[model samples]
Target: MKTPNMITKSLLLSAALATSAVLCANAQIKLNSKTVGAATKAVKAVTLSNEDVIEYTKEYIQWMDEHNPVAPADDEFAIRLKNLTANLQNYDGLNLNYKVYLVKDVNAFACADGSVRVCAGLMQAMSDNEVLGVIGHEIGHVKNTDSRDAFKSALMTSALKDGVSSQGGTAAALSDSQLGELGEQVANMSFSRKQESIADDYGYKFLKDNNINPWYMSMAFQRLLDLSGGASEGGFTKKLMSSHPDTQKRVDEMAKKATKDGFEKPTS
Candidate 1:
């Protein structure tokens, strides 16, 4: 027979061992998720996440497909977009896709379902490095699942906001304003300071991990900052800021990080 204190100690020990085992298992799962991330439980769970948020994201995508629509597949720029995406190397198993449009708006963006669209203007704005940076940023959106999370938040926001209210009751009732908004926002949304920072981090990690120069992202930010004129008010200069963080801030952050990371020789 065991004394009461011994029994209590034994129970405590067993509980601690069990807790450690569980922690170890969870850590392993997290590490595995980080490595192949494309098909991990969380990855697969993206579709199965039964929360209101995930549901809204899926519903919104379906709504947009049938509604606002995209440029046709036969556009000549579409052909170039295809060429660029096809040659995309160093990124794998991310499940993102790409498209191009002839829109004269001068923009680019990525959606949750692996859909990325580049404007003809954006295509002309970049060389190999800047293009990779923009593409990497888009890929960051996919990797972080920001698209889904944002769509969910935007859906809830739209339902409560004037944007949806003024569209008429029927539009709100049958169609997904959240989804429609997601479609437009994904292409044209500007991230908050925090979101922009996270994307910058992701962009750096992606380029660094892939052995590409992390400075390229900083370089692209500089170009956007210079061309966009960075929030001095008015015209095409503010276009990027309308849907993203101030290019100036992003460039500064990237430059600082790159220097710290030993940007000994930037790409020419």
Candidate 2:
């Protein structure tokens, strides 16, 4: 039995298909079937409202707090992290919030609610500019709405499988435990290669927009490659290499981009 919302969605999809057919027949420039299909799918996908997204974000933050309490805003590392992310807030009218985890992992992530989480180890390992590039990459995820997609996808999957709620239900339908599981799923998600590449490009634009040396993007990747000992695969190296583009390839591209943009390499 299709729910009322499901029926409505089905009708919308049918309409989209009909419209695509008409457009294809009358179009001056031949429309690619793949492009039309992608556009139709984008319209058909079910997504949560902004209010529900925020609710999920708050729940996920609470769960993270329980499992991995954030470093205090006044902590030394936290202060530096804040300083690093300060410039990012005013970009494109986005007032992003920053937090530092006391964890030792060399990773960072962002949330749909404009929340940015940086690991203390990342702060210690990279220079401020290098750290900024990483944060820029994370910000790219939020700016690109990848974070929102991840949250919506995770919540919808859980709701359907776990009977948490209907597609249109408010966030209140999810229990704390279910929200916790959703958060865990979100944290572990590996974004698609295309998405990763887009984020990297966004990060580049971010650094250039702020008048920061964009070469740090290459430097950051090179640093990781060196840390990984340029291994073909294994351990952290595997994780880094498996992230969409090859590590060395990305490093070379960033270097080429810097030169093309008339940004000179730093004197060492």
Candidate 3:
């Protein structure tokens, strides 16, 4: 009953509506695709395998070694660390490698891959026995699988943040920027009080097993306590205080354990 012009107008309106519907549907499909992709990534992040962790950690450590000034083989710090850890090359079931970073930051860390890094500042601050105690503590973290867990957590966070690709069941190589972010996360990582205690116990036993005086454990904590008192808010000393918590109590506990085991504190 309508005129030709009216029919033509109706047809145009229908076409416009149909086009709009198609566009909206396409937009919705794109949004849903994105949501699915993000969800898949999240799942991958959560279900990261141990192999993935080691792979990512290898990349991160390589990045760190490239960025930091590692002590040369002939350097005093390197020589000292090599001498100290010579016998520790094959501790327990883990094959360990030691390196000293020629940095002034008083820090030491061990990775899941049995890579132990000691900072020069820490070496200068403590006696040989005390340094061994600190190294023992780091090794304890590795022995307890805490280092692995920490690296795993860091990898998960980095994967979620950086959208690390995992195509064909293989994790993608991390970009340098992503490696930097991951290194930062690791540098600021903190172990729980329980984990600290466990590592402390392991360090204690590690010293005794190596025929070293366990009194050095208390001495190491005492040195850290002394350093914490003079350290700035952002210094590694203060960070260690915050992460380890109960400094005096831990020192006292180590001292008590050492005394109970009949190990006399050496007077230097």
Best by lDDT: 3
How do the residues 1-268 of candidate 3 rate in per-residue lDDT, one tens digit apiece?
0111111100000000000000111111111122337666767767877777666656545545555678999999999989998899988787777777776767677767667777788899999889989778777777777777776676566544435545567766665445445554555566667867887898899899899999999898788778767342333454344555467888899999999999999894
TM-score ranking, best first: 3, 2, 1
Between 2 and 3, whose TM-score is larger? 3
Ranking by lDDT: 3, 2, 1
Candidate 1 structure quality by residue, lDDT tens digits, 62-171: 33333322446787666666665665533656554555444343445555555555556666676666666766665666556665565434433333233222111122
In model 3, pairs of residues that clash are none
lDDT of each: 0.46, 0.56, 0.64
User: Where does candidate 1 have its weakest 10-residue lDDT segment?
Assistant: 12-21
Which 10 consecutive positions of candidate 2 have the poorest summed lDDT?
12-21
lDDT of 2 at 175: 46
In Å, residue 145's CA in model 2 sits off its true spot by: 0.9
The number of the candidate with the highest TM-score is 3
For model 1, what is the C-alpha lDDT against the true structure?
0.46
